[model samples]
Each structure stands twice: as C-alpha cells, then as structure tokens.
Target: MTDSDTGHSPVWARSKRRRSSGGGGGAFFGFLVFLLALFGAVVIGMSIKERSVAGGGAAIDGWIATGKASVMQAIGKAPAAADVAVEKAGDAAAATGDAVQAEAAQTADALKKQ
Candidate 1:
C-alpha cells in the first residue's frame, strides 16, 4: 500500500517524527497515568471514611449479636434428654455401690470363718 493510503504518513516517517517531537505524547500519557493513580487513591480513602461513618462498624457488631442469639435459640430448642440421662446415671452409681458392698460382705464372712 502507498503512504497516502496509510493516512498520508509513511509508517517509518511517522516513527521518525514521533522520535523528533521530544516525546510529547509520552509525557502526556505519563501525566494521565499520574492523574488516574491520584484519583484511585482519593476514591479508596473516601471509601474507607464512608464505611467508618456509615454503620459499617455497627454492621459487624450487629452480626455478632445476631449470631449469638441464633446459637442461644438453637440451644433452647434442643431435646429435653437431660432428666432421663441423670436418672440413668444415678441408677448406675447405685448399682456399682451395691456390687462393691456385696463383695465386702463376702470378704468379711470369710474372715470371720477363719
């Protein structure tokens, strides 16, 4: 293709001109990059400030309270098996004591016979 077909500037010639222009576009691009970086920093800082002011801290506290309430509610609704378990535990202890007493009585009888 001809140079005129390619926007009236030869590819190599445009490259030469760009190099001769002391990098103006490069400087402008660098300035744009700096501006964007500053804008991003400002946005992040504002976001942090907004969250601190707009109940983000309260939101976390509320979540913790809600979680605690749910746990308590779950515990409240658990099956009532404690009474039966305690009765069985008492019966087991009594049986264990009786077995020990019986063994002691047999030992005492043997000593008396001797």
Candidate 2:
C-alpha cells in the first residue's frame, strides 16, 4: 500500500493552519483596559476640581481679613482727626477775640489825642 493509503501522516507534513474566527479573550481584555483608563481620567478630573474649590475658599478668606483690617484702621484714625479739628477751632476763636480788643484800644487812644 502507498504511504498516502494509511491514516497516519508524518508530524512534519501535518497541516499547521489556524482558524480565522472572532477575537476571543483579546477583545475582552482590550475593553477592560479602556474602562480602566476611563476610570483613571475621571479620578484625575475630580481631584483637580476639589483642589480648585479649596484654594478659592482660602482666597476669599484672605480678602475678608484684609477688608476687616482696613475698617479697623479707619475707625482708629477717626477720633484723632476729630481731636485735631477741635483744637484748631479753639485757636481760631481766641485769635478773633484778641483782634477785637486791639481795635477797641486803638479807638480809645485816638479819642484821647483829639
């Protein structure tokens, strides 16, 4: 009998063909990788947003403190300014009285000479 008539084939002569069927585990693994990447992106975005909110809160606090300090400074200066204004007014009144007295003395001396 010819060698082909026997059911046995030599291992070196056997077909090494592969099937062209649907992608099995590789496609599922790729989909899992995509989901993991999406999850990572979401986590990063949330982290940035949280940091920004915290920073903004601190900045607002600083502005409020500055405004309070300015108001306190203005309040402290008000009484000093008032005291200076009162002193100046008293001085002006005294000067006006002295000028009137000097004019009366001049009129008396001129009448005595006449």
lDDT of 1 by residue, 1-114 (tens): 876786788679889987879758878888999999986675566558657534544554576899999999878766556767888999999999999999999999999999
Q: Write the residue-wise lDDT of candidate 2 on 38-101 in tens digits.
A: 8667556655765765565565567789999999999999999999999999999999999999
Q: What is the lDDT of residue 105 in candidate 2?
A: 97
Poorest 10 consecutive residues by lDDT, candidate 1: 52-61
- List clashing residue pairs in candidate 2: none
lDDT of 2 at 78: 97
Pairs that collide in candidate 1 are none
State the C-alpha lDDT per candidate: 0.79, 0.78
TM-score of 2: 0.45
